[model samples]
Target: MNIVVRDTLEAAEAAHVAVKQAAGLAAEEAALPFKQARLRAEEAMRNNLTQAKVLATRVGRLKQQALEMARESQAAQRQNSTTDAHRMQDSARELMKEAQELESQAKGFQRMAEATRGGLGIYALRAKAAATRAAQRVNPGGDGPLLLPPPPPPLRPAPRGSAK
Candidate 1:
């Protein structure tokens, strides 16, 4: 009889442990998507940074080319060329302007990448906070969540015959 009772207790304990293990696994599985999304966002930020670097390099080269072209146009005028020097000057100025615009755009993309990285940091912090809150809800102790208190209720309407 004692052997039978011990076997029953051991079986119950094993089942309980299995259930808890399964619950923990389920929680981890549910959080997997969030973890994947966070990683993707981080990768996207990195890609944006890389693209910005490439754009900056292109802009620099474009500016250098424009400057060289402008110098060549000036040297042509000195060589007593009969072509329209003013037209060449105007073309050089326009190319330089476009290059400057491209540089500005590259800077803008760099700023966007920086902002996205910041946002990812904030997102990670928020996810951790939310997970902590959920754990607190389940356990209610052991480094409780730093949750804020609920807001007060709205004012009720006065009764129809209430004093003014």
Candidate 2:
């Protein structure tokens, strides 16, 4: 009888260990998909951040070019080259519009990056601030006073030559 009771106790202990091991394996299997999803999300966030940086750089260049063209247009107008001034003004307007669009795109990317970053990590905060600054620089006045110069006067048709 003693021998049978000892064997039964040992068997119960073995069964307990086997159950625990099976539970652990099941937990890990259940978590596999979640882990994979997290990794994919992180990769996507990294790609978005890289693209945002590129866009911000492009916006900066476009803003600078637009400002320079605006200055040139003002100079041409001051020099009384009406046709040249009008041309430069049109070019500057187009450049500024493009810059504005790019700036908006950058802002959207930044928002997504921030949301993915999660928590209050210093690096994430700094990146968000930098993105905001870049957008501000691109747009400048932002519905307030106009940064670019006013449009040039409308073009006038040249007078017809008098018939000989």
Candidate number with greatest TM-score: 1
- What is the per-residue lDDT of model 2 for residues 101-140, given as tens digits with 9 covering 90 to 100? 9989998998887787673354444544554454444434
- TM-score of each model, paired residue for residue: 0.68, 0.65
Candidate 1 segments whose C-alpha is farther than 4 A from its true place: 82-84, 126-164
Minimum summed lDDT over a 10-residue window in model 2 is located at: 155-164
Question: Model 1, range 73-140, lDDT digits (tens) per residue?
Answer: 88888888637555677777887888788788878878888887777766566556656555445444
Q: Give the C-alpha miss distance for residue 96 in model 1, angstroms.
A: 1.3
Q: How many angstroms is residue 44 displaced in model 1 relative to the true structure, after the best TM-score fit?
A: 1.8
Candidate-wise lDDT, in order: 0.66, 0.68
In model 2, state the lDDT of residue 29: 52
Model 2, total clashes:
0
Off by over 4 Å in 2: 118-164
